[model samples]
Target: MDNLGMVFGLTGAAIAALFAGIGSAVGVGIAGQAAAGATSEKPDLFGKVLVLQLLPGTQGIYGLLIAFITLSRIGIMGGQAPTTVQGLLYLAACLPMGFVGLGSGIHQGKASVAAINLVSKKEDQFGKAMIFPAMVETYAILALLISILSIFGIK
Candidate 1:
């Protein structure tokens, strides 16, 4: 009970890394499958498929960034340990990145998969096809900004 604050902070950091990482892994896997399928039929689209597959990978980076920030702030990486309230605050801060990363990552992967299919079918539509997956990244970016701001804003 007494260690609740630190526990919360630690858990938040863990979630930032774990959930986001899982999301990226799943997303990449999904995109990779589509990419492979597309490439098998149209080998020339390898570059396009690769780009689409990597779009979801950004969420993992965002999650990792949030995790690093949380850990650093919580004094796990260094510095003084936060109080119970501060720890809980860290947890709250991490939530945006964790949840958003997970959702956006998976959705982006789906978007990428569709994009890959489009590219496979119409090589000239690559520009428009890339936009769909890129749009999904907007939410992940917003979440990342919120988490970073929250972490730094916390005293």
Candidate 2:
């Protein structure tokens, strides 16, 4: 039973990692395309587009954090097995951050693409354009918070 708990915890963490990585990959890829298009039209906008391209990276970071928390809760942090129930709780803890980060990241990419278009026309609008994607990042933050709280609640 104890080993089973750890297994569930590790599996959930792995799933979170997978989803988050995929989300970041897709989001960044989309952003990269937008950046390329913008840069091709106006080479001077390269710097602006680069920042947008990097924005999606936060999703990966959040996923990593959730994975770490889950592992820690499973006692992988201390090189021992956690209590059975704790491990099960740890698995549950990882879900919100994983899904929310995944969904938000993909949505952010759309905003990034729009921002790139805005940048193409008015360089000064780059900052304003970023607001859209930045707002989307709030969802990731909420998810991260929930994961952290859930891990703590597991005792």
For TM-score, the strongest prediction is 1
lDDT of 2: 0.83
Instruction: Give the per-residue lDDT of model 2 (tens digit) for 1-155.
Output: 54987888897788678787778888989999999988888898999899998888798898998888677667577545766676677777888878887898898888888888888888988889888888989988888898888877765
Residue 16 lDDT, candidate 1, scale 0-100: 82
Model 1 agreement with the true structure over 44-145: per-residue lDDT tens digits: 889889999999999899899899888876777865578899888999999988898899889989999999988998999999999999998899899999
Q: Tell me each candidate's TM-score.
A: 0.96, 0.93
Best by lDDT: 1
- Report the backbone clash tally of model 2: 0
Give me the runs in candidate 2 sitting further than 4 Å from their true place.
none
Off by over 4 Å in 1: 1-3
